[model samples]
Target: MTGPVLYGIPNCDTVKRALAWLEDRGIEHRFHDFKKGGVPADRMDYWIAALGWEALLNRQGTTWRKLDDAVKAGVTDAASARAAMTAHVSLIRRPVVEWPSGEITVGFTHDSFKQHTREALM
Candidate 1:
């Protein structure tokens, strides 16, 4: 389909909401569940490059809070960020949408997703 792949944990509330939004709008998408199918290191690297480490990491989540201090301290660069995300996929944020055209977006808000859905339909 023309839409991008939507990656996140299935049980995450944000992910559930985003999925419902897409389904309601009849937007085509492929899902990648973090807990079932662990995130690929290469894909994490790509997202880090495209969206920056700060954008890709979900600091507001419970997963991040549970990280050991040493691990949290080690996240200083793209490689370090990738390592941290690989170790704790939940800290990589929920609902990372990778557009077919190669854009990587993190997080989900109804307005933001609605705009993306419109663009994908075009």
Candidate 2:
């Protein structure tokens, strides 16, 4: 079965776990390393449109925590959030899986992955 494009920093524990889960399940996914490849602006735009910036942004992460107070404060709406995410990809959630069927998901969870797979298979 065709898998999704899993985008995240390799060192992130969440991303590592997601990758391990895929490997353990004999799933094939394309890994996009944020550090090396940088965020794809067009893909980001699509995700922002579909998921909304609030849903895609990782406000609880260290990256968001480390941002300047002003920068953090500036992300008040979808447009601002997208701008912030464009400037700092780490602010975007991890393991953003763009499935073979063009469905996009943020974050990683067993149930979520299963659902995505089911949707793709359909």
Q: Estimate each model's TM-score.
A: 0.91, 0.90
**Model 1, stretches more than 4 Å misplaced?**
none
Among the numbered candidates, top TM-score falls to 1
Tell me the whole-model lDDT of each prediction, alpha carbons only: 0.84, 0.87
Best by lDDT: 2
In model 1, the Cα lDDT at residue 55 comes to 88
List, residue by residue over 66-101, the lDDT tens digit for candidate 1.
888898888898888887888888888879998766
RMSD to the hidden true structure, all candidates: 1.4, 1.7
| Cα shift from native, residue 59, model 1 (Å) | 1.7
lDDT of 1 at 54: 88
RMSD of 1: 1.4
lDDT of 2: 0.87
